[model samples]
Target: MNNQTISAQLLSPFNMGDLPLKNRVVVAPVTRSTVGEKRLRFMAKYYAQRASAGLIITEAAVISHQAIGWLNSPGIYTEEQAEDWKQVVNAVHSHKTPIFLQLWHCGRASHSSFQQNGQLPVAPSAIKVNGDYIHTPLGKQAYETPKALETEEIAAIVQDFSQAAQLAKIAGFDGVEIHGANGYLIDEFLQSKTNHRTDKYGGSIENRYRFLGEIITAMTKVLSPNRIGVRLSPNGSYNDMGSSDFRETFLYVAQQLNQYGLAYLHVMDGLAFSFHELGNPITLAEFRQVFTGPIMGNCGYTQETAEAAIEKGDADLISFGRLFISNPDLVERFANGWPLNPLVDRKLWYRLGEEGYIDFPAYASSS
Candidate 1:
């Protein structure tokens, strides 16, 4: 295609409800274990560096202390935590970038050491994932069977999500994304293999989707329905999760979410770039038909692949994860067709320092 044709086809703005994204590039939610005060300066610097993207989704911020099952993951339940995140939000906003906080709950993926009073992790079913280990202050330990959440407890958890969304807004996030993906609590209820409950939250596809629907409804009241989004991994088998009726589960969830008139649906295409057994092998285009709203495609996407996805109407937006980890100015590089800086250290991916976090050189400096 000619330059004009290519530019016309590849570069276009997307309207995510009331929010107008300058382009289709989004910085997907990524977790770095900077919690409380430590995360304030670090996360602010990190996001401000990548401010060129149309939108940035902050790492999954735990909804409550009970919901936090990982070491150093940030929480949104307290006033102090919200205050700390306000600085990060302000930093990104100063660069004129819109950011959304990804609200999360680990469910059975958490260990007792991470829980208060050494309480058991909660889930729809009291099952322990088979092959995963969790790091504790004491040391690494095998996953433990979680306590099945009682029906009453489920209501409380939903409220926690609602409260967190409110807190996120207070923290000055442009919006909030409910993390219903990656085998977390919401995903646990959505997947049959992980949820054996016969209550209102499990069994039939509709019942299994109850938790997600409730969460969306609750969050919508706190934030406008047009400002809310959800991230899902339909075929994701992460954390020992599966569904005999994957199509039914995801399709129903999408249809239900569509009724809310939410801003967008972020779908992680698990089978795009690899031969992995973890996520279902669904294409981003397939999910497009199921979800009529704006869709953000993620997972193993390159600049060319992302551009193609936008050109073909497979996705209205593209989210970059690890690539953004090393190259904060990823959108500018892509716009100028510049070479990417190599990921120098994978060890620093989850490390709690500014070495790899803030020290990556921009294209101009590297050249």
Candidate 2:
């Protein structure tokens, strides 16, 4: 299936199973923890502004009370939150765009202040991943050694994700992407450095991958495999996540996910902020080899590099992170070769205000 080497092919249509995409540009989930009707209202407008993107993966939304680690971050475990997210989904769909809600659990990257009754944060093991701080209502706090999830508690976490998938459907989202990336709950379970358990949820590579596998299985009871996706950062050092078996674990995980026939596998392939810098890097091609479906390459992707990736068959889609924040019309700018709005202030990124949140101006039109 040879396609044309068109200049702005990123603007072309793509069909991810039953979901048809207008372009290959995806809005990677960024942390925006401004919670409330006021903030949700602005967020609706924010996502609507970027409707030209083929897909918009929302900021990580907590699955349950136990999953809240970020300050004022959104949640999907309640009816109120689901009702609130509908506004954002409806706004984006008004422009005929598809959006996927990203479900997350921060695991050991959290503080007890974010947990119920100040209970210790749950993780695969009782080990602490240093150099990570979680913002609490009080203030920023360092990560503490987490409580190893009891065998029974692991099932509860998987149930939380499954229930979140059902709520996302009620919230009018096109689909849901399991936040298996970074050093979140699922990531901690996947890497050996964090997962030292001897149960069915850890130990061997297959056992470490079971936590996510169980989630995908349970989530499928509500959403089909075609409507579900998973994001993975096999080479990440973020939240202090890495392992001795980085290459072997991710490859096997990718191979097994193929059996589920999911929509796509979103992989963090760039070296910037990656733990693979000190070791041999694993390429996206490795995942593509076994997972014979759509692959979305993320991190540090520019228009030129993204186009090259698409041309060379390295990726079926490219998710833009910081670029999408400053340029609401990123797909349009890339399609027409328009100048992009440079990101001005990094501090405003996580702040709870409209200063840099929704104030990024679109390109000045040349009449």
TM-score of candidate 2 on Cα atoms, chains taken together: 0.95
For candidate 1, write residues 321-362 as lDDT tens digits.
Answer: 889999988876777767798864656777676877888878
Candidate 2's displacement at residue 163, Å, is 0.5
Q: Estimate each model's TM-score.
A: 0.94, 0.95
What is candidate 1's CA lDDT for residue 147?
96
Candidate 2 lDDT over residue span 237-274, tens digit each: 89887787899999999998998889899999886656
TM-score (C-alpha) between model 1 and the true structure:
0.94
Q: Give lDDT per model, in order.
A: 0.83, 0.87
Please count the clashing residue pairs in each candidate, in the order shown: 1, 0
Write out the backbone clash pairs for model 1: 235-280
